[model samples]
Target: MTTALSPVDPDSYRALMAAHPGGVAVVTTDDGLGTPYGFACTAWCGVSLDPPLLLVCASTTGSTLPVLAGRGWFAVNLLHGAGRRAADAFAHRDAGRFSAVPWRPSPATGLPLLPEDAHTAAECRVHRLDPVGDHTVIIGEIVRTTTTRGADQPPLLYGMRRYATWPVP
Candidate 1:
């Protein structure tokens, strides 16, 4: 069954999404100029298993969005508990996003993959694209993956007003 809510304001939608905690990740790819581009995204998700698919959303106006959408390959570097700063750095429209962060190449996709706080890395190839509101949902097929030293490290969570760590129970 499908359900719908009464039409709400955009702020309400933002507020609602803000209330739901999400794991952080940096999606990166080279822009064909030997220069890498990336952005922090909380909208990344696993989409399928048989084809090894994943999805990441990018704002229509984001500078790096075009590069990522045009590139055939990209990498999703899952952020660990200490990656809050890295997230903030990449989230902005700045040229120094990579200068402050450390990364290496993904053997499968040849994309830049974060080497630190990258609890998990997924090298992917673009599979499909869907326009959703003000963002584009880019679906990819995972080609390679790695689990870093922080397999047990709590993921950096974004919700409401700030970053948080999952409590150990």
Candidate 2:
């Protein structure tokens, strides 16, 4: 029962996960200087309901990681099926990601909110940050949430190294 298995290579692991689809979200934060930072993320999920906890994994080398860790707050903008462009914009690591994306500040925490692309947005206070391998798992306690789009709208998804939309019938 305690047989040790060989570690999987990075490329192999990536290939395995590419078969599993997940919803897309843009994780955003500010540098406390009015400059915003964000990245398109698929590694996120709800953790608990009682305390309203959710987790999003940020790349260790990502630019937004330091800012959000220092600021102690962030926003999660859940993309709709029509938000492929916004997702693509933030997916790249660059300083101009926000130039084309229309956004406003969240009411509660003043974090960047994707008003046009996001179907649902959550403002959170960072509860814990755990560094795991090449990514840091950010656990957030949801402070405020907003639903900007209707339930009939499908969610944007990523899998098989491509972007796809959930089939809503």
Residue range with the least summed lDDT across 10 consecutive positions in model 1? 101-110
Candidate 2: the clashing residue pairs are none
Residue 22, candidate 1: Cα error in Å is 0.6
Off by over 4 Å in 1: 1-6
Per-residue lDDT of candidate 1, residues 18-49 (tens digit): 99989999989987666788899999899999
lDDT of each: 0.86, 0.92
lDDT of 2 at 123: 92
Clashes of each: 0, 0
lDDT (Cα, tens digit) per residue for candidate 2, span 1-169: 6998999998999999999999999999998877899999999999999899999999999899999999999999999998888899999997899997888887678899997898999899999999999999999999999998533589999999999988877
Runs in model 2 lying further than 4 Å from the true structure:
1-4
